[model samples]
Target: MNNALEPSAVALGTAGWGGGWGVEPLDDGAWAEAERVASDALAAALEAGITTVDTADIYAHGRSEQTLGRLLAADSGLRERIRLQTKCGIMIGGSPLYGVDSAAAVESTRYHGGADHVRRAVTDSLERLHTDHVDTLIIHRPDPLTRPEETVEAYLELASAGSVGSLGLSNMGVAWVRRFDDALRAATGGEEGIACLQIELGLHHRGLVESAVLVNHPDSADRAVVGEAGGLAELCAERGIALQAWGSLGQGRYTRGTEQAADQDREAAAVVAEIAGRLEVSGEAVVLAWLLKLPWRIQPVVGTVNPDRLRAAAQAPVAADRMDSLDWYRLWTAARGAPLP
Candidate 1:
């Protein structure tokens, strides 16, 4: 992996800045306030040695992109000092159903399209980002209807046109990545290939680890290709591709006590709390630190409208020695509420 793509300790997530995942709409004043907060957040991230900020065109209907662009435009120096990553793929319409919404509804509402949409989207994103090019551009998710090669062709064209620096895929199985990787290699005459693969990795989704070795059936094969647990980390180690982690906190479920697996959850939380209490930090910080300890270079995508939460996540201390192998298994088992077969 190139130093430019190596995983930083932290990566700022823009989901919360632009109304936050369909929870609420930001008014003009709120949007302006978000821009200020985002700018300050980016400044702090840069100062903390975190060089990446991840956003998407669909986020707040391009408000996140606009905000990020405005921040960069405000600080001419900071713009060049950071890595920018954004994804496209999932189409959103006013019907409230994403991707699964009807074509008529999609067309009638605000429908974000596929490759063509991506092209226009990137252009708009760049304009809003106030940058000529993006360091990393990711296909947010797989378009089942579109062939992988077709998608790669579009991304390659963007790269060739100097609109993007590197290409990546997200939420795809191994087969899709391999197929896309092959397509990109073939299309670019082997000059440029995929630089990274982004996926949901955390305690809840350990399926990737299991899927890595079970390549056979269609589902298993897909898992095998896409779910290579530490393969991304190991590959990044070899090629310098950074393994960026999304949903690092497991959607806040890790913090709550639940009945389905109350004992396990509580035990794990207690273990994390115990460590955090001793270290004088939040459980979220401890969770993030644990993620950093994995074999792959991890850049956590953290979402927070709260500045204090963001700071705590950015400053989370990694206990290099406190979490032992047994303790790790204990916590994992506690989280799962059952022994690994």
Candidate 2:
């Protein structure tokens, strides 16, 4: 916590608070429960010095935004202490059977990558979040058909107009990130650059490392990769960029009660559990501590509506360096069920 990197800025992901994305929907009673859970989680997060949150408009069909809005409205002081980051571009439609709408489905049928649409979506998100300006605004994903310059220009315009404090991009390849970074720099008269790049990085998903090699593209020196982001630790050392790690717990596959917990998962969990017991902590604390041990600045975006779990996660990094290299690799190999070459 006292490192040069401000781990306290670790963000809380609100995707689960809205209860979407293959997760159970929150009924009226569940919504009330979520409010209490979120409130308690937020209280604990604030107390633990975690003051940033990452939410998305499409999460739970805007339910996440609404819930966050309500929470911030209830406590104005909390609003000031925290920095809100939300995404746009992904569209979702209302539904009855699926609880809320599906953003991916909506975009597939009626996708428009225009500035007007971007403005309208951000405005709606701001309304739901009950805030005038978002600390960070990211495009959930780039439209394959849209021009990079056009999208970057739109984001630059928003920043210039003071609608968004900073602009970021998500789910983009290394080429796209560099292209947008250059385009935005030119469009903004070199006044601003990308604040961050959000991507999925964890023990199981090391694709970012392979992708970084492709982004470097020795064959295309003219198109060098810009805006460095990779494995949480590597990226931190290379570019001084913050790593916002999503799915830090492998989407709950590592948990004890989940059906996705296979033998490999159980074995990995056992290793985590043993380490936790030795450290006098929870399994989640051990997983997070491992993440914190990496050289980079990682802010795991954990998505749980449970306050107790949130508190435990906040304390996970307390003994980051206690685990030896062999133990770390043992857990890593068990999690992968394979040895490194």
TM-score of 1: 0.79
Task: Give all candidate RMSDs, comma-separated.
Answer: 5.1, 6.2
Error of 2 at 336 (Å): 1.0
Instruction: List, residue by residue over 1-341, the lDDT tens digit for candidate 1.
Output: 12255446777778766545553556888878878788777766666666778888778767788788877788777666877888777666552323343456354444232577678768878887898888789888876678777777777778878888788777665566667777877887977778777778765555554344444546555434344452555554555456677887666555553333255366677776676677676767776776666666666787654555666676544542455566556556666556654
Error of 1 at 310 (Å): 2.8
Model 1 misplaced stretches (Cα beyond 4 Å): 1-6, 21-26, 95-114, 210-241, 255-264, 278-282, 315-317, 320-322
Per-residue accuracy of model 2 over 184-205 as CA lDDT, tens digit each: 7788797766767677766555
**Predicted structure with the largest TM-score when compared to the true one:** 2
| Cα lDDT computed for each candidate against the true fold | 0.67, 0.67
**Model 1 accuracy (lDDT, Cα):** 0.67
TM-score of each: 0.79, 0.80
